[model samples]
Target: MGTYRFDPIGEAPEQIRFRVRIGPGYGSIRIGVDGIPQEWGWIAEEVADYRGEKVTRWRRSQALQDLEAELKTVAQAYNADHGSNVMTDCFMQAFFVFVESEDPGRLAWRAEFERRRRDRRA
Candidate 1:
């Protein structure tokens, strides 16, 4: 599992408060807010380049069922607990990366996304 802290892109620093822990290949996203935990299933699509064409196919993991529930419910719960809606907006701006671990391309993509996110906040 990989753990990361998600910072709100266009909100005040104090309003940023969410943690995302993803399983290998993003089997799930464990969202936490103010130390409360909620689990959500994650889905991934396989993209391939074949004959100079880009193709994407949705794939399902055998360990879990397809995600039929909304993941934002976790954010809603967090907002209710804090008596504030900041988390809702934060969740709206979240970027969920589904690349293989330690992949250079994915790292670069995430870095650039973060750069843009910071600029938006600025």
Candidate 2:
């Protein structure tokens, strides 16, 4: 099993800063297909950040799409080769947060951990 957390960094002027980290070897294995920087989230800033630009800036340029497409192709190899035995479980934020109520589950789980930690200390 692995764990991930997101954190924001120093107050910025023109840009917001955030970091995404995966534990258990510090995401050294790099299980994902896309170029999600260890210091950033799932979406690569190179592409996702400028998606609103409509191919204007460097991020919206053809190069970015080419990179994203290549990454998708590489990732597809996993499913293509191991179609029956494999499953890449994924969920959208709204789906997991609102539809499935992951927040409640996470809270209940954290509460249990806190209780156990307190018990151990006692």
Candidate 3:
């Protein structure tokens, strides 16, 4: 497992409030935030080249990092728009959507759909 910490936005230096951890498994990677496990599965799609070469573990690790970065951006956007921090459950849901298609657009659509559903309930 690899652990990483990020300081809160516009906060004092060395003051960290967020943490992300990743654990690699057999053809899968588990992500956790602040010690809470968010999601774990084969989120990255397997790719083949003309020579029938498949994606390597390093590529999968790269994919995990890319996904994490994207999720952070989305979470920041959500916080900015809602004036509140995004919950782990929302991240988990987005991660699940990503696992389904590995497409950021699909994840965005899912988030919008969820927001609309919540608005209807409110």
Candidate 4:
């Protein structure tokens, strides 16, 4: 899977960081409209570094929806033809992390979009 990092919009600085990731071939494949095959599944975690200790938390569906919507836009930019399908595959095999940090420049999901695009062409 590929890992990505970006600061959430209209949020407090250094308060929280968002991380999106696509699979390294995780989950099962399913057929969609017109018998188009795509993967399906998702994992999300909330990790907090508190007092030099790491704690894990569960995320609500809203977080996943936000991430999915953002990634769909990315997929559309990658390949207009099968953007939604490719994005679905990506999301199905994704692992998201909502971290508490301030570092940036870790976006890496484009490679996956390109790979899925190539697969669609094949």
Candidate 5:
């Protein structure tokens, strides 16, 4: 099961909140605020040629860094409690190599999907 962790920031009453998903293949975490799932997308690269030399058109570096930093602050307490970097992608947020974990309930759908996949492949 993927773990979910978060903390309030700025004492601002949490007008908005974000999520981090931790699961196999990075496709397990899914939750929503105000009944809407936060925008989630995977960065893809267009290989013009050459192996590992692809460029992504949707690279929004500064914005992503800002969001990542915010999420990290909120999830610090959670990370300490759980002993996991399930939210901030300790190595780096760009490249999408490391994925943060979400709350357990956040991954309910992912858990179900994994179970189904395993049962089918078994």
Candidate 6:
């Protein structure tokens, strides 16, 4: 488990910080804004393919897409309240830093994890 922290807006006040806590799986991930945990959950949706077959799929609600969205919302709110011109990209860059830091040996871990999941489904 790792807890990564970064400032959404550069040189912003300490109260405007963000923290991401990641554990073994997607379910153990969490995001915090200003030390207050934000609400996040898994998302499921039905999708139809070209053949018109519909299937339900689940995704991590706070992964890249949802994480960026939530961070943008927070950044927008902060800009509106404080009259600061902070770009949403700043948060994403900081997130990428954390991702890069965790990348070492990640391929092996991911392969093993996927194999275990596949075995369970067999």
Q: Could you say which candidate leads in lDDT? A: 6
- Who is ahead in TM-score, 1 or 3? 1
Reference-based TM-score, model 6: 0.23
What does candidate 1 score on TM?
0.23
Looking at candidate 4, the ten consecutive residues that score lowest on lDDT are 31-40
**Residue 1 of candidate 6: its Cα lDDT?**
94
| Residue pairs in collision within model 6 | none
Candidate 3 local lDDT, 63-101, one digit each (tens) = 345545655665444332323347643332222211212
Query: Which structure is stronger by lDDT: 3 or 4?
Result: 3
Q: What tens-digit string does per-residue lDDT give for candidate 4 at 21-120? A: 3434533222111111111112334466667565544332444344345545444454323233564564432322222311111123555678899999
TM-score of each: 0.23, 0.22, 0.22, 0.22, 0.28, 0.23
Where in model 4 is the C-alpha error above 4 Å? 1-64, 82-122
Root-mean-square deviation of every model? 15.8, 17.2, 17.3, 18.2, 13.5, 14.5
Tell me model 5's lDDT, rounded to 2 decimals.
0.42
Question: What residue runs in model 2 are displaced by over 4 Å at the alpha carbon?
Answer: 1-59, 80-122
lDDT of 2 at 70: 46
Give the residue spans of candidate 3 off by over 4 A: 1-29, 32-103
For all candidates, the clash counts are 0, 0, 0, 1, 5, 0
Q: Which portions of model 1 show Cα errors greater than 4 Å?
A: 1-100
Reference-based lDDT, residue 119, model 4: 100
User: Which regions of candidate 6 fall more than 4 Å away from where they truly are?
Assistant: 1-40, 58-113, 116-122
lDDT, candidate 6, 1-105, per-residue tens = 979765334433343346666535433334444321222323556899688999655443334344445465553443323233366533322221121112213
